[model samples]
Target chain A: MTHRSVFVVSGGTGITAEAIGNSMLSQFGDVAFTQHSLTYIRTEDDCRQAVARIQAAAEQDGTRPVVFSTLVNPTHRELLNQSGALVLDLFGTFLQPLEAELGVRSSQKVGYSHAVRDPSAYRVRIDAVHFALDNDDGGRTHHYDKADIILIGVSRSGKTPTSLYLALQFGLYAANYPLTEEDFDDLRLPEALQPYRDKLFALVIDPERLTVIRQERMAGSRYASLQQCEQETRTFAAIIGRYNVPSINVTERSIEEISTRILAQTGLQRRIR
Target chain B: MTHRSVFVVSGGTGITAEAIGNSMLSQFGDVAFTQHSLTYIRTEDDCRQAVARIQAAAEQDGTRPVVFSTLVNPTHRELLNQSGALVLDLFGTFLQPLEAELGVRSSQKVGYSHAVRDPSAYRVRIDAVHFALDNDDGGRTHHYDKADIILIGVSRSGKTPTSLYLALQFGLYAANYPLTEEDFDDLRLPEALQPYRDKLFALVIDPERLTVIRQERMAGSRYASLQQCEQETRTFAAIIGRYNVPSINVTERSIEEISTRILAQTGLQRRIR
Candidate 1:
């Protein structure tokens, strides 16, 4: 595999640059690349310093480094463009067109770049995150009425992480409940969840995967056994079928995929903007 | 006060499209935009359907909607190009240049678009999320030995959310410890956290903002009073000063900004790649 040095440069958090760079690089599974970030580069002096670093890196490696950037300042961008590297200045490529389409001059100031962000949306994230933590893993059933969606699954079925992702990323009030052995006694929906049956989103995972995950958590308990994993998932399916709750198998999906699927299936509008 | 409809269309999750669109649109602070996501769009048919939706939206609104997309297929890109909208197809803008730079034909496959993603990176995220939650809110100091960084702050000073974001987004093992009144009684670091002194990163917030956050949580209690907020923050400063630990004022910062600053200040490498 050919090795390359990749750098993400930006004026603010560099999240936008980092996100796009990583997303694009994932396509080249055969390439071996090391990534670095130059975040919070604000002044023209900062841009000059970053370009010097990039130039040094390119010379040291004897191969042009790949630089992904989102610099709003044209002067700063011109300096970076002249650097001895393959600079993909994303803002340089799209800003003029966006300015034309909107029929307004961009402030040209550095952006506080973030994913799904604004002051109001920031508030929503904090509130949702607190809600998710407070109501995590069936810790408190008293607050389900306020939850946008409730994730239910057997223990180690990717509930807690999904709940936090939905809350912290998209600003949704998400709560998760782990279905345990006690719930498998009758394979019936728990009484506390009956009132909010319509708000439930189930996560179904491969029994083998669940067993492996449990083993990592508790070494050699019955919970880590394949028999218990199968039993819990079987009971989980029965309960979901009995109630006809919307669900998806998360065997090979990432947390982002699971949350996006839930958003699509449940028709929940993400309050990100 | 112009109102614009913004649609993020992608062959995959549309997360990158949405992120770039939102980040750019935020620069035009005067215009109002309602954001929509067309996620998991994989087929030519999906592209045609999405263009129709965007065109119909333009017709209904009298002004053309802005469509940001990342379609991998040329045929699909051609169809979307004809849509009566400001079609800022991001992939079309950068792919050719990226392909030329790499000396390799780009795979042009529909991306698994995520902020930071891959199967191995996905495992890191899950383990880190679990670790963060397990050690949240000073719940279990037993696992301090494994934490990559420990976030210490007064209650409701943005510790937990930053810890969760660091884990979920950056694959860092972060644990948050909330400082309390009892810790302030003797004006010393807690015995539990004493051994991990060098690993601590303090969050110092404005007392007024801290009071407001506490008021929202407790409602009309001394814990939510500005006096107590001042006392706690003062004590927090004294502790960090005494230990010569690094810290940030998180009152005006978002979780992403806090995490990014932490990464920069602590020289911590994010394992997202």
Candidate 2:
């Protein structure tokens, strides 16, 4: 492989950029990727000092550095310019679009308002990016075909979370797909996926449950109406039937029960070992 | 406030599906969500019987039930047909795509694998759907305007995980965005985001440290090289200077340091009471 330059995503408190960068990093394990957050550089001089450190590293290594960052203001941007690294300005990029979409000025500090990543799932500590890439199967498509089991459902049907659990715990390469209105209209499988008929597994839920889910987003929107939800649920059921799709009604099932039952039915192994 | 149905996702060994389902249920504070796993239904007859119960509930409530499930084979799909609930087929959707992309079939019993949502990041339990949504900032631009801080950086810079930590730990509404190549080329803030500059903050990382990170995926891909990585870092630094962006480098800082530093720099109130 050719010698690659260092790509630095600057701007502290940038969790989303961190995630995307982590995701991208997952694709090329060979690249040496490091992330730093400039948390308290307030003045131009402070920025200049920071820039000196960055420039020193680049010059010492003779490697070009690429920086990804969000700045507090225009002067901060200028200070970073002296560092001589390629910069991706997230603030500038989203400033206009975010303003237009929200009808308000950008509050770049939004990330500081919330603290949601919980470390309770596993006894061991894992960083967010490491955990996501370690758990993500976005590029692992073949694993789906080899899966002894499969999950299906509409949005919020619990496919993603469940799949992660299986992969993390039982070593299952579980994959999920959403059933959209378009699929219901044709009442058929996407032509692209017609081959896995025998291996296909379906997840079914009650319309009442779906309506409750939609209510969370738009409590009283026409889309969340009981009648509309009911119709959609019924249509989904009918579509599954028309295709002779095999499925399981998960209305009252627990994760363990579902996995066990599916494994037993298919005569597949329960664990890797 | 319409009568809504509840769809529960469950399956797989090690309680991955169940854990995910638990997360999904937690998202809705006011809804009756029930979980059932295949463990309870051992035979085809048992599956048929379970479907009947679901159907009965739907009929009583005048709503169709939604099912999110992971099953070992298509047989359960047939059994679920006995129930009137609508079905979503995850296996069918993801299996082929994965197979095509990875050139490796999913393991017969690979464990849960939703990697994007770092279950370990938050204090509460979350499922796959929850993980996906956690990354989705509300569509409103003003959403971040009301935010205490915005996180900016490249992928895997610990954005999603950090943001989630802030949200769960403090109830802060955190939103994050990815910085793309296009953003770097343009250098100027995305016109839409021009208004939020005042509240903006940046995250920075050291080039050497970043190289350490990129090495995990491909070890030596050009994209992951220190030289290439350094160039990116310099570019980012320069852009921040040009735009006068306020930023921080997270090269050697812990999450606490980075998070606390951001809070101080932005002068935002801590979420904890």
Candidate 3:
């Protein structure tokens, strides 16, 4: 299977770019992909820098590559004009025409409106969207019959939210499984999951973020302790390494970017839209 | 505050339209409006019939005008061609422009994919989106100070999912308050919540659907029994009635339609987006 590079998403105000990018990522299956958002790009120089990165990804890969982007403005369009990759402009192509046809003025509320003050809600929805992408039965052999993807992660690493997002937004049957201490100590996946090891997507996150998340749920609780969170995170990472399983660190990116990268990396052809 | 006679969002996918409409619903304080979705209209005749109902709504008391159908297809648009109310064509406005800008063969995936199955995801997201509209701490009296809009209900009544959707999708700080048995007995809004009663959007559901959703999480458990579900639902309805709170029953309807209607009836305008 050939791996494509460069997925771009541009569109509505709130989470449109991230949402579309995440959808495209689920289609890719397990190779790593880099996502650079132009939301912070302040100058033409920054735009060119983004273009260079896309050009590099294209040169490194030899396939019908795709670069998905969602831009409300035309700046990113000019940047990608020379990138030699398939670009997806979500805003101008989809949102604008629909706005015109519907005769409604632009509301500018879709992607850019996320409230950072309440990162708890942001993280939850982000996790929901990503969790909904696993196409395999939630790490259980019997349930594989129902899964389009299986997501494995330690507690509060964002499986539920991501799973809901994928299943809800895309009609994908996504299931999630929590990795327990037993699974880590055993250092082996269940026999049922062994056959579909290649289909698993391990969501890795930094201990600090994990701790913060757990603390919100059970403040001052042992489960929310930083030490426990770090230990579990480390063990989970080692487990993935031991099995040669592919994983993604969700410490730095938003849910939309993370899901898109996973789909792109996985190279799983989405059989249904 | 000049309340629009009706706010009809008749475009985009059901999920997106609901999400936007839900957010917009929080803006009109105390003014009543009714929301309807055109998803059920399988024929042009159905579309015309739905429009007639909407016209009747617009002609009702101008303060509590009706918010009409979100026509998702061209046929619905034809039906609304002469409807004098405010028509919001979300799908048509968002989809075409996105597809054209992307230069893709189709924009179906990103613009308006249908919720063919397991629509719970979309409903949750849309509810969250709607709640986010009024999530604020300023000038919202004590008890009400913590929330802009508090979604109260028993388990599996779609509270958490909706709250997060409101926060993430529309930047609303929507917080959910679960209705415990104690609160049910009192059958009144928390005294703290009384000051903001005007801002409340009660989400009531049909006994059957409420049972179905709760059963999914606790299958075969006593909590999942239809009798138990029905009893709880009745109690919930009684509580709303005792308080004389306004609400809508979400049964045989998708979340998009229900949330849209909630917005219209509330006469709430979404925060600028």
Candidate 4:
């Protein structure tokens, strides 16, 4: 396997640069890489320092570093270009076209992208996180009317993470309910969730993976047993069929994939957008 | 503001495309855009379908749509290119150079990139979220030894969301403890937190913002009063001076910014990379 020096440099948190860089790198399955994420590289001086670090890393690794940058300032972009690394300028590539199409000049400000400019809008996202926490896992089922979506599944079937992800990423008030053994006995939607059936979304997982997942949480209990997992899987399917709830199997899906699928399947609006 | 139709198309969840698109478009602050996210566009057929949708929307909106995509398949890339919608091929622009440097052909497999290939590793992030929940708001201070970093802040001072973001984004075990009047009585770190001093990171917020945030949560209460917020801010500053703990003022910063700055200032490593 080949090794490479990788750097994700950005003016803001560097998250956008890293996301696209990782998505692209994920396609190349062979190479090994060690990533250095240098964020808050706002000024020309920061850019120069970033380039120096990238150059030193390239020299040490005996390979040119791949620098993924979202630096908006032209001066910073030019300074980093001098490093001669494989610079993937995430912003510079598309900003000019967007600017031309919009017939406006880009602001080119570093950091403070959305937070300070619209504090109230950002606060809604934070409030959604609190709402998810307050209503997680049948904890506050009475508040179902307020939720944008309600995820239902057996315990350890990914209801919690999905709820949290929906809240954090999309600013959606997502409440989840873990279908207990009693509900599986008759394969019926929980009485508490019946009132908000329109907002229901079911998640099912493979039995083998559920066993492994539950085993990690509780090693020897019946809950971790393969038999229990299979039963739960069957229960989820039966309930989905009976209730006709919009559903997806989340066995191998990332939170991003699952959340996106949910939004697409349910035609739910993301509050962030 | 000139209105335009924006499309984010991707082979995977489309998160990478949307993130980069949003980050770049944030620079062009004035133009109004209606974004349509098209995810799971994998095959040549899917690409053609995506283009049809984009072209239709562009025509309806009376302007060319801007497409941000991370499509990897060369055939799919060519098909989308023909859409003539000002496509920003996020992966195509950088993958060839990466392939040349790495000396390998790209896998180009869409979705299931990380989840199925490395389920155990992905499970670590979910486990981190559980850890954050289990230890949230001084619930399990005894588990501090397991934490990569412990955030200390006043209530509604961005501790909970920051902790959750740290756990979800970085896979770091982040437990947050809210400092109360009891702790601020003598401007001291809580006795429970003293043992974890090396892992301590303080978060301070502007009194005006805190008052407003608190007012939203508990309107007309003493806790939401500007006087109470001012006192808490002074208390936080005093405690930070006394304990000499590393900290940041998260008054106007996003969770991403605050979390990144926390990792940088504390030199705490993110477990994801």
Candidate 5:
């Protein structure tokens, strides 16, 4: 099998290139790819240097690298094209037609996706993040009314990260509550959560996976034991089923998928685009 | 002034459309647009429904709507094109050139960016996010050894959100510590932070902005007072200066800029591309 290298190059934060690279990775698995790389080349000189580096690596490995770039500068793009790699210009392939269709010239600026100039949107995201931290693991339940969505799960069931993702990505106010042994014993939603039932979304994971995650944090404890994890998972599922709470199995899902499913189920609007 | 509506339609997660919309907003202030819009239409029927909705809205105001789309399906793209609106096709204009350059067909899949099938990258991001939450506001200083970067700041100075953003977007292990009155009184770094000095990055903000942020949390407390805010800001600045701690003023900056600058200054590698 021949080894292949994939490089995601960009003029800015490289988010666009990364997104494209991720999409490609999902489509084509890691079978032939030895390296998945990122190069942030902001200027013409940096672009040339990056291309030179790619060329040097290709020469050594005898495998022409695949480059996915979103460089907006024409001069830099020309230099990248001359590098003898399979260059995919994310912007060059699209911007001209978009400009003609919109009846306006493209700004052709780098790092435009996540610019710092928009203070209001930034502030909203920051506030939502702070909310997530304050209300983490049911630290404060009084603020559930203020939350756009409340995530409920057993400990280490991936509530905290999903809460933070929703806040940072969509500027959505998210709060997560951990279901404890007491709640599991009673097999009911917490009294505090009753008022905010409409906003509650449960996240559950496979007992085996939960055991492995817990073991990493605290080995040889009841918390990390498969038996305890199994019990907790069963109780949590019962509660979710009883309440008819919208839930996702986080056993094999990413925070992105969990958050997206919650958003789709709840129809919660993002505070920022 | 005329009221105008802008819609970002995509067959995928709509991230590209959203990025372009945000860039346009920053370039042209929200003079013409009412709200930043996003419509994720994955199926042909969904596309027709979205177009019908747009057509209905356009008929009401006689102002043709502006649609920025990344529909990869030719049938859906054609439907979008016939919506009687000014449509900018992000993928339709770019995929052909990309296909020809690479001599391969595009996948043309919907919701490809955050697909759950690719779990390794997603797992890394989720783990990084968990690390961030575990170490938030110096919650668990013991894990500082695992952190790629540690952010220190006075309270409400935008540390939490930036930490979470760095984790979710790049899968970087980021931890943040809040500088309290006790640390400022002695005019020294927290004893717990001394060992991790190399990972330290400080965040500071304008006294006025810090005061305003605090005021929202605690209306009448001394923490929210301008005098207290000014004193804390000065002490934090002095500490950062004394230690030569790499720092950024987040007063007028977005979390995106703050996180990007932090990553650039620290030279930390993103776990994910």
Candidate 6:
């Protein structure tokens, strides 16, 4: 129950710091965390000013702050090392050995991870994103041929977001289809999705959670009713079972876990590095 | 141009490899990159086998492979270091120095970054993704009160994908509204969005690109015509300027660039680390 302050500091966009912080959170459980990016650290004064703020915060808390940093520059990293916080220098720890192993110097550039210098990879991601949107909720089922994976699920069962996540993160063409009342009544896969059977994945959620999610969208309607949710989920489960659809119960899973599981299950290649 | 093979090897999911590869791509431009994940290397044989594969690949190409790795285990890393390829051990370079700075040892467990051990952060991301989908293209304008930022643009101008990317990557509750013909004719902000003017951001695209994109969706129609695309884009630009809304021309930019710029412009806090 002890309180602690965690600061994720970076010389760039702080994505590395955020990622490391996420890992730390997963390992250590919950802690109050803040993110700071030293994106404009041009001079020694700027680096010192940034460090001073971390020092002041550590002093106020009466505990050494835990700072996760990915500052690529040596001068900026040195300034952070002078702070009262316990610094985890991501780039400093990794770059030299990397340089030696590669027999070439590391670029040591800031904001390189999410930089848009490579238009081709960037374009791949954008196209995938557009594909996800175009095919969301069975909107454009004819494009299933283009999709790497087609996620089928009842309404509000985590299909849309998971599809988008797969698209954006991995540049996978993910299309999602909602199992409607007609499909459930017949207990069959939709005709359009039949040809792409191998490309199909299913997402299921707890009926209770599904109801709650639907209620947020449409309060007091049959679509949001617990009875309808239970029936739809039961029918959807049968449909997935009949078709041998690779499925995940999303009630307790994150989109990362869902997408990773989908990729692993389907043995699909991510288009981007 | 010399053709070189790039390998991303990791004891966990090869996210570090993907990230570093992205940076390398930005700095070094294009190369043939491959990802090989050594997820569960529990023995010497596992390490040796992985290393041999890399050596074989390097030999085939007549060039030492540039390997970006996040292998946490010492024994496994040593095995890879012996390979003929140029190996960059991401964790090896960083962990010890981080351990010294923090006065503690890292767990050195693999798959730490995308691990679903922290349900709170996972839930936050899921909720944000759902929010983004729920409010997409003004589908549910009432929820604008809850949105961190509402992206407004003409149809097919990269609004939907950007909104979802913001949500998925940063857990920012982004809502997008497609400025329709009715709004354009009036030459004013949509009545529903006026109260949230400060939260408004805009996306503009090249009319030619818009026509091509729309043609893919619905060809040989007014919606896909170059003249219509130009007119809608022109009106949207005027509306954005009239409102003094922060906007980005997505003609030459990628989704990563678009989302990053949105975050920078809005100063919105990402719910995730």
Q: Model 4: which docking level applies? A: medium
Q: How high is the lDDT of residue A94 in model 2?
A: 38
Which parts of model 6 are misplaced by more than 4 Å?
A: A1-12, A25-33, A39-89, A104-115, A120-123, A154-157, A180-187, A204-252, B1-12, B29-33, B37-52, B55-67, B71-87, B104-117, B180-187, B204-253
Write one digit per residue (lDDT tens) for candidate 6, span A42-159.
Answer: 5678778878878877787777777777676788888889896778776676566545544555555664643244556666777898788888888888888888999999987888
lDDT of 3 by residue, A1-273 (tens): 334554543332233344345433432344345544433344567567767777776677654345555444466566766676666554444444434433445554323322221223333333333334223224344656556677789987767656655543443556777787777777787566776676678899999988876776689998999999989999999888988878889775444445545665676533222
Q: Model 6 residue B113 lDDT? A: 47
Total clashing pairs in model 4? 0
Residue-wise lDDT of candidate 5 within B1-273, one digit each (tens)?
A: 456667778764566666755554433332356443445576889988988888887887677777777676789999999998878776676566545544556566653654333556666777888888889898889989999999999999988888889888788999999999999988899999999999999998999998888887899999999999999999999999999999888887667668766777777777765
lDDT of 3 at A55: 73
The local lDDT score (0 to 100) that residue B98 gets in candidate 1 is 73
Model 2 vs truth, CA RMSD: 24.0
Q: How would you class the docking of model 6? A: acceptable
| DockQ order of candidates, top first | 4, 1, 5, 6, 2, 3
RMSD of 5: 4.4
* Candidate with best DockQ: 4
Q: What is the TM-score of chain A in candidate 4?
A: 0.94
Tens digits of per-residue lDDT for model 4, B76-132: 989999997989888888888878877888887663434323676579789999999
Error of 5 at A224 (Å): 5.2
In candidate 5 chain A, where is summed lDDT lowest over 10 consecutive residues?
A: A25-34
| Per-residue lDDT of candidate 4, residues A127-214 (tens digit) | 8899999998899887888999999988988888888888888889999998888887777788999899999999989999999999
How much is A215 displaced in model 2, in angstroms? Answer: 4.2
Better of 5 and 6 by TM-score: 5
Any residue pairs clashing in model 5, and if so which? B12-B111
Pick out the ten consecutive residues of candidate 1 chain A with the lowest summed lDDT.
A110-119
lDDT of each prediction vs. the true structure?
Answer: 0.85, 0.51, 0.53, 0.85, 0.77, 0.75
